[model samples]
Target: MTLRTATAGDLTAIMDLERTSFPTDAWSEPMMQSELASPHGRYLVDVEAGRVIGYGGVRAVQGSADADIQTIALAEAARGRGRGRTLLRALLEVARERGAREMFLEVRADNPVATALYASEGFVEIGRRPRYYQPDDVDAVIMTLDLVAWAAHRAADGTALDAGACS
Candidate 1:
């Protein structure tokens, strides 16, 4: 798998996976287009055999103390291979490089795999939004991570956090 900065040209592929992963509340094309064009957002696509299979994004303004995880999705066939974790770590690194001290994200309450991934990354649940996901009416799990502490922990374990590893 090859992960790299996403371009507008990858929109169609990204949307395909996005809709498949989040059928109940997939982002609209216009909204996704605006996100890809936003200065505050950094998106990445995972490609395999020249086909886009996964994608994720983070919104971090320069000099900001906090950032938001915009989204992360992998094609059904690509699940359970640590690709999602790789995409997530890359996004966190991007936010940290942009001067973010904390990272925040919301996951569907019904999605245990995603919630577990975030939790394993040191994200702690801070709150929840009832029925935040429409159509499905699933609750949203709000989680946050302190980048400083996370980096320190990784260093202590002698594990280098290299976003480029995915690239």
Candidate 2:
């Protein structure tokens, strides 16, 4: 798989996977379009044999105290191969580069897979939003991470916290 910064052209494929991944809570086309064009957001796509199989994004304003993980999704076939972690780590790196001291995200309370991924990356549940996911009545699990601490931990473990790690 090849990982790269996402471009506007990747929106169609991103939306395809978005709908598949979040059947009940997919963002509208206009929202996604605006996200891709936003100066504060950084989005990425994972390609395999010329297909966009996964994507993730984060919103971080320069010098912001905190950044938000807007979204992260993988194709059904791409699950359980550590690609989700890779995409997440990439987004965290983006947040750090933008001078964010902390990061936050909301995951579906029913999705243990995603929650575990975030936990493994040093995120901790800080709160929850009741019925944050509409129609399904699923709660949203809010999680946060201290970027400085996370980076220090990764560095102490001899891991490169660089964007090049996305490969």
Model 2 scores worst on lDDT over the 10 consecutive residues at 158-167
lDDT per model vs. reference: 0.92, 0.91
The regions of model 1 sitting more than 4 angstroms off are: 164-167
Residues 120-152 of candidate 2: C-alpha lDDT, one tens digit per residue: 998999999999899999999999999999988
Model 1 — which ten-residue stretch has the worst lDDT?
158-167
Model 1 lDDT tens row, 81-164: 999988898899888888999999999999999999999999999999999999988999999999989878878998756775
Model 2: which residue pairs collide? none
In candidate 1 the C-alpha lDDT for residue 141 amounts to 97
Quality of model 2 by C-alpha lDDT:
0.91
Cα miss at 122, model 1 (Å)? 0.3
